[model samples]
Target: MATYDLKGKRALITGGASGIGLGAVQAFLRCGASVAVNDLADDRLTAVVDELASAGHAVVAAPGDVGNPEQAPAMVAQAIAALGGLDYLVNNAGTPGTARPIATDDFERQDEDFWQLLVNVNLVGPHRCTRAAAEALRATGGAIVNTTSIAAFRGGGSSAVYCATKAGLVSLTREWARALAPQVRVNAIAPGLVDSDWMCRFDGQDDAVRMGQPVPLGRTGTPTDYGEAILFLAAGAAYVTGQTLNVDGGLTT
Candidate 1:
């Protein structure tokens, strides 16, 4: 894992109970930063918090559903409070909007409710969290890293709605970077075929293995790969903003 001089900084990572979000939390902690983790309120969230705390990492639980507009701001505020302030915000929470991939021709499956869910969670959710954290971030000249996906550019994801939402996030990242200029730097990471619990729901272990065969890296990405890129945006990429770093191991190249 890569290291950085993140000591004394404070961060909040949404959907941080596992996968890339949890990996970000661990990365920040390893670099001596205090991190507040946000996820849906549940036993899993509690377990993650306890486990990290037991290992002597500076982590706190800020649980709420980002899909809920009302809950999003509250969750951000709670995380900011827990961390005393916020220097970095990782908007990693999102959903595929289905248990299985919905092909582009599956128009019947793309109902109003499905579109609403994907938009609310993947698009509006990040906006809500960023808006809520803007003031705190401005105060500290902080940074924001959004988790988009290769689907944003390459297309073909778990659902058409999922791809659309991530593409919207790419646009939002550029716009937000402009909006928060000179104080809070905003950027995004586009991950590809990450091996995680979330992706496993759509692509089984065997599927992931097969998918990795043609990649330049000869393997699927890991949460730590994303974590390192996220940390770079937050702590090391001083002149970088409004850009989408494709952490796909040359898959997009």
Candidate 2:
């Protein structure tokens, strides 16, 4: 946990209600940056923002569904306005569309709706947010950090569609770096198995003990692990862009 002098800085993190996104929200606040937390309009969003505000951290609730074409840009605009400007945009919203992993050969299960849902949230959603926040980011010379997945690189994921969408995001990250250069830098992180409460759950399997066994580090990653990397890319990493860092506890190695 390196300390960054993020005082007076402002950031908006999508999917900020829980898991890695929540971790990122805390990271930014700890470094003295005002944050606008975005998620679907839900009770968790209210509670998280209220809790941070009560703690005297400058936090705002900017709730909306990134999958929605209209709400995504509107939410980013409103968040940027609320923050007075933006220094960082973390495009962390995404979905696996399943409580358990769908077998790769389960073609019948990998239907049209499943593919579309993954694409909408995991791929197009980031594009929507980045595009909406581009001008503000450019003005401030801010950076964008996208939450991709180790699933983008290899075979193990909830489904084929989920992996494909994340891979698409990797491509977008590179293009966005070029599109916003000399003003804003863009990068991504591909997380390995993480011990977080999200839509993707392993029934009767302990993520730390089961999934951790395969990781070279012999542990599943916590939100803090990925969060630290997110913070670095957003506030630091001046010379880094058009890249995807593997925050996977050496799993990729």
Candidate 3:
């Protein structure tokens, strides 16, 4: 719930239609930033934009499937156009590629197609969005905050492929920080068990209650928790980059 004096700042958040993405959008708006939210082109996108706009927020829609290479560039371009320029890009779009966790021993379930889908959406998608937005980000001396996961380090995600893709993203965050240095900053967030639709897929309401008991914080994460971390990385962490902030309520510890 922290606020910043970001009246003129502009941001584009991929997967901004819901969950952490939506939370970031609201946080940026609360701090007086004009935000462009990106999600797969669908009715949900329209609904979210409308809902936020109705609430008097400076929000615009920039819809496209980040997983589609052919569509990623256009998505970033449209977002930049909508915002006039980009100051921050939150690469938050990702997928688990399954309805539930797939155990490592279930070799048959870890098929090539599952691997391909997860890689395309969770790994390559961020690269595509970042590449497309690099010039504008450099122009504005902006920052990039990628949405990684605790799975990257703990290897306890829905699938091995899911963990691998997040791990790849962590590597990319460092490399991109180096590549985009002296102009733009790049960092990442590794969330633990967030109470979002995505997490519900792995742990339903009942299980989530039981899961929270083990966390040091005694509760699951919320979208606002992630949004605040992202806002810090984007608008306040002037001297920070190439690092992954674990907003996991000490679960990883």
Work out the TM-score per prediction. 0.97, 0.97, 0.97
Q: lDDT of model 3 at residue 60?
A: 95
lDDT of 3 by residue, 1-253 (tens): 7779988889999999999898888889999999999998899999999999999989999989999998999989998998899999999999888767666556676889989999999999999999999999999999999999988998864688888999999999999999999899999999888887756665578776667778999998889999999999999899999999999999989
Model 2 / residue 245 / CA error / Å: 0.3
Query: Tens digit of lDDT per residue, candidate 1, span 129-198?
Result: 9999999999999999999999999787567788899999999999999999999899999998788865
The 0-to-1 C-alpha lDDT of every candidate, in the order given, reads 0.91, 0.91, 0.91
**Model 2 CA deviation exceeding 4 Å by range:** 205-208
Tell me the tens digit of each residue's lDDT in model 2 across 88-133: 9999999888866666556577889889998999999999999999
TM-score of 3: 0.97
**Residue 136's C-alpha lDDT in candidate 3?**
98
Residue pairs with clashing backbones, model 1: none
